[model samples]
Target: MPVFPKISLRPEVENYLKEGFVNNEVVSASGKAAAERKFEALLNHLSHPPSFTTVRVNTHLASVQHVKELLLDELQQVWQFNGLSVPVLQHPDLQDVLLIPVIGPRKNIKRQQCEAVVGAQCGSAVLRGAHVYTPGIVSASSFMKAGDVISVYSDIKGKCKKGAREFDGTKIFLGNGISTLSRKEIFSGLPRLRGIGIRMTEPIYLSPSFDNVLPSYLFLQNLPSAVVTHVLNPQPGEKILDLCAAPGGKTTHIAALMHDQGEVIALDKIANKVEKIKQNALLLGLNSIKAFCFDGTKALKLDEIEDTEGTPPFSPESFDRILLDAPCSGMGQRPNMACTWTLKEVTSYQPLQRKLFPVAVQLLKPGGTLVYSTCTVTLEENEEQVAWALSTFPCLQLQPQEPQIGGEGMMGAGLSGEQLRQLQRFDPSTTPLRDTDLETLRDARAEDMIRLANKDCIGFFIAKFLKWKSTSEKDPQK
Candidate 1:
């Protein structure tokens, strides 16, 4: 049963998503009832976190088994402290993935009047096993003091004003927690405390906090996000470009796959996010990654250069491979109880993605690979982009992805069955999580859990393309 109501989007956005899910192709293929059911399931799943917390073991530093042992030891301590136990399972397909089941919507979690309210983004993090940090806290009870037990709730509709005395608007209880700072310290203290504001003693969902846990050897990543790197299959001593790579999850993964022997150019428009990419690369001990703050849409240069150095705006077709994890309307993110995006905002990413696509194709060398992915379920961003690329770039040819664990591409994008087979879409709602208690989960086969970990992931889409034609031979009309 769904613990919360279907995700509350602006009425127009909701209708748009519903229509996309129940399009003519989907209805004709699955029947109207099944298509509607799938759409409803998606709405329900969006308000709940994924069942498994997936992490990628930095195999360059330690083997998967060694990392697993270390993580299990840490989890044991976490469980012992919290008076709870959860099984950690390794993926059968992904050599470097570790999965931990998330237990949720814990019944009878005691609520209190001393309430702490967090923003929607913060609440999503809390649901995914993060403590409520000071920056995320929107409000607290007027008299709420330090160390007082309180009930944490997410302002699902963005109705709670910052530092407000109380919020009565639509909110969902996250769980019971103990305040780390008094209301004054949070709202009025000089510079304000920046650490944990609410230590979740009883979260609606229980997962171990990964803060500073095996910093060098483990990267907390979604399962499908990790899959993109493997599918790219970067070889050692190759030059790769990651367009719009921040926090460097896939960039570092690409570097690790290449044994850190090749150059991986990571770019993001924002300077701070680029710094985060550098930081993550540094933390993972990956030296081959070069992160830059540059807009990817203008990354290609028409001027000829004698030699290609490691910077943006290089001569065209400089990279051996390129990964375009384009920005999208993130309708696929789980545990997003509500979104405040306007209809215009919801549909704004297609043009930006299109702007970046030509640059990605231009930067990729002949016979090189390019993988486009997004953490969203929009047809316009996923299958529609694929269709648009195929029509616009004759040099680009769709290729099959390795370890195709996700479902085939979604319908309503005018992609043929054969073409759609090459695309991967991980829709959480289509495959329901199998209910399991601690004992049953502990006794479950590792392979079974691995399968579950693959299917029941956040909504994601990936498509790999190969540049089989040289630029000279490319048709301008496409």
Candidate 2:
């Protein structure tokens, strides 16, 4: 039953997560044994890739059907050598989604004496169907040649040296690949990676690489991530603000939903990330987005200058809708294999989220919507934050979401059933990994496969709220 090792966490961090899952509410609902089992399942699930690879069709450029056909053609051409024929299916609930089953933790491949090691992040990408980029190669065999077959390993513990001759630390095997760059070329080729360093000939997992495959027609996004924009439900010609937008997946999605007619202001703390957002918007041909390199918490305008002109520090209640896809510990990402974070680092996001919450509320117009989301499974960042939001801001009320595919909020947060139902928690712990065979998957019913894809995705949480206060309502914080 065990495919990959359980996700590695510090003892304290593991205990913290354990306590939250085995809390009173969860125990009362699912019993002690079941809750513990779920927790164990979660740890194991995180180390392995999800059953399906989800992509959101860029509906602005082409129809979902059109993109699906193009993707199928490309995948068939790429996999023709290995006779890999995976059927690409549309999500029943989400018309814009296309799901392709990821096929392995394939255990039959023999290891090669020539070895190459990649960083944890790059290793995760390989599991999700990416070739090893040159910059991500941490260490390679000293005598490794470019065409040599190499056993690829992920330095999951982060102990591998940058240019070491060999590493004896804890590493997980990620199958075999052909080295495209020698160790000399890898070390010398600095500043930027010239090309893909390792071309995977036999990956532990089998999924299609989207490197140059219809980049404009489709976006490689997790299923729940695409769902966040849909729950925000950005209408055409409405003023929307993405509080912590970077690399602009959701921001671009919102603009596309608005038919590229309305203003979609995106903010990120980093300048490079802001540029990435702009690039995504440009690539998608969506011009309604304006990305700013500024803190989302300090975005509110306390000054009397009513005309701030399309910049940061805008007047109160300026946006018609807001999306706070807040930064978190990111524990919910799959194929993580390990987390080298201390307990302090793991628990540091709640305060930042709270600071951003009030600012989002202040910037939203009366009767506007605010959708808060995180790519994490923690109670503090998910349910606990929702409870805090409701108590601190009376204007914010939990609102129901369409396509409620994820499970209800975890217990022990003091939220009622109805309140929890309004929150969507895509907990990987609750959803066991399914068989990832494409042939057998094709035989399954569409509804069954769609449900499987929804649950077997990156762990995510989303909470939508409606601001019920009037325009004249006084600021709660002030």
Candidate 3:
């Protein structure tokens, strides 16, 4: 059941998205009414988490089956401790992917009188299976003590003043939880209260928290993110480059797919973020990854002299494959109740993404593969970029993905039907929401959960291109 209204966007932002959905191509393909319905559906789905939690197994250390067994045992112990049982599923198409059902909108959950308010970011994390930490707590009942049951609300408008006694601005109830610290302990002269502030005894959506669970064998990741690495299809002994790699989710995944035998150079401009990539690679026992703090767009050198050591500023076509998971406007993130960005801020990423694309193409070897991806749903960033690349580079050709689970690329970018077929886009709005009540959720089967998991993922876009020797060498205008 739909517990909340569609996500609240600024009037201008809403209008912008509405126009994107009801554009000429979309309306001509699907009637105006259908396009309007999809646009509204997208708004609603953005406020809810996906129906399942996706975990990517570290196949470099253990087989998929082995990891699955260990995970099953660990989850079984957790469920037994909670006095409940739930199913852990392995995706049929994705080899190293595992799924866990999320039971939600639980009916008849009693509300409490005392309330606790949290920020938008904290609320989103809570909906995705995290407890309320002290730093996230914006307000609490003045007289409430530890062990007190309290209602939780999200400051939807971001108007709540930090450390305020109470907030009367726009706020939405998330669920209920028990206070782990007294109000005084959280706000008073305690040097710092950093751990969990509230234990979510009852949440609107129910999903298992993966904190400290199978740290070495499993990685909590979005389904489409895992797909990006698979589509790259790294080999056992090839050199790869990951541009704009930070916190290294996809970079580490590339190393695992290659069985830690090849050199994976990961680069990011931020020094702290580069450390995070190195940390993840070390935690996963992947030594093939070499991380550096440098801007990827400036990685190319015009010098004729060659450096013996394999590092940045190398010759053209130095890498066997390249992954440009460019930085984008993250409009596709789930459980996002509000966005305070202006129209200019929302559309500012395309130019930077385009600047990074040429550098990726220059680094990729002839007969190499390059995958460009974004976690946004706009046409300008998704399909328009593909159209731009195909026109600008004569040697590049679109390639089909092996396990194409998502829908075809969206229209309105002048892309042919065949070109769209080669792209994969995981769009949650296109999938109709189930019109069942709480009872249906209580009795949902494993198969139904699995089906929902595949379709109800974040809005993401992926396009793969293969670069061959340029034909212009033979014919100047070719």
Candidate 4:
């Protein structure tokens, strides 16, 4: 059963998406009847959380089996229920991956005397596998003391004023927990923040919190995100470029896969996000990554000396592999209850993505790999862009992806069926939302859970292109 309603968007935005679904060729392939149903399913699934939580174990340090055993032990200690038993399973495709099905909207969880209100972002994290962070706490009952059991609620509409004594606006029950700090201790100074304010004992959705637990040995990333790094396949001792890499999730993974042997240059347009990339790289102990605040659209350094190294304004055809994970209107993200983007704002990313694609192609060496990806499900940002690239760049040709887990590319962008097959698309709506009432669905086996988890992932697209060697250009001297 669908636990949440269809994701709420502005009327204009909804109409825009609806038009795309109806008019798009791939969606309409089965005729208008099937297209409408698929569109509806997409909307419904967007509001609900995924069935399972995925953790990518850092195989560089600890083995997946070792981490799985440790994680199971931790869950046993944390859950400790007489009748309930939570299982941690390994992913079939990914070696260093663990999956845990989230048990949620549980029946008959009693409300506590005290109450604590948190933001929507924190609420979504709790549904997954996270503990409440200090900053997420928005309001608490006036007399709520330390050690008091309280019911946690999320302010979904962002209407709950911070530090308010009471919030009557729209809120949803998350779970129950015990307060770790007293009201005085939490709101004493001007900042009034320190440590964990609440320790969730009986969360509605039960998933293990891996915070600071095997940080080096395990990376907490979404399943689709893990697939992205694997698809890029950065090789050792090769120079690679991560255009628009902030927070450095994929960038760090690429370096790790290369055994920290090659130089991975990570660039982001924002200065603050660039700092975050550096911080994440340091945490992961990946020193090969060189993060900089630079516009990827202007990445090529024309007229620069060829001898110059380890600096900005890099010469054209410098990197062996390039990842253009372009900035996009993130419409495909799940559990997004509300989106405030105007139609203009939503459509604005196509031009920027187009501008970045040329530079990505230029930065790659002849016969090098270039992967273009986005988190949105829009035709303009995905298939249309691919069509444009093929038309504009004669040297580029689509390459087949290994471990093709996602569905083929959508049809509407005038690409032939053969051309569409080369692209990878993870569409969450295609998966069946398990019926809650069915005993088989409730008690699904581990293998079944893993399959569901993989299918029920965020909407994303990846297209890999191999830059063919041009006869006119001479080989570089070693």
Question: What is the Å distance of residue 208 in model 3 from its true position?
Answer: 0.6
Counting clashing residue pairs in each candidate, in order, gives: 0, 0, 0, 1
Give all candidate RMSDs, comma-separated: 2.0, 1.9, 2.3, 3.5
Candidate 1 lDDT, 228-291, residue by residue in tens: 9998999999999999898789999999889999899999999999999999988899999998
Best first by lDDT, ranked: 2, 1, 3, 4
TM-score of each: 0.96, 0.96, 0.94, 0.91
Per-residue CA lDDT of model 2 for 1-478, tens digit only, reads 5677899999999999999889999899889999999999989898888888888888888888888988887887885225666778998877888998888767788999999999999999999999898888999999998899999999998999998889999988998988887889888866665689999888888888888788888889999999999999999999999999998999999998898888999999999999999998888888899999999999999986566787998888989999999999999998899998999999999999999999999999989999999999899899999999999988888999997989888898999999989999998766666556556765788777777787788889999999998545666999
Clash list (residue pairs), candidate 3: none
In model 4, which range of ten residues has the least summed lDDT? 434-443
Ranking by TM-score: 2, 1, 3, 4
Residue lDDT tens for model 4, 168-208? 88787878988888776766643645667888878776666
> Roughly what TM-score does model 2 have, to 2 decimal places?
0.96
Measured with C-alpha atoms, the lDDT of residue 28 in candidate 4 is 54
| lDDT of candidate 3 over 141-181, digit per residue (tens) | 78778999989989977888777778788887788998999
lDDT of 1 at 20: 88
Selected candidate, larger lDDT, 3 vs 4: 3
Please identify which of the two predictions, 1 or 3, would achieve the higher lDDT against the true structure: 1
Whole-model Cα lDDT of every candidate shown, in order? 0.88, 0.89, 0.85, 0.80
Sequence-dependent TM-score of model 4:
0.91
Please report the TM-score between candidate 3 and the true structure.
0.94
**C-alpha lDDT of candidate 2 relative to the true structure:** 0.89
> Which ten-residue region of model 3 has the weakest summed lDDT?
78-87
Which stretches of candidate 1 lie above 4 Å from their native place?
79-83, 305-308, 433-436, 474-478
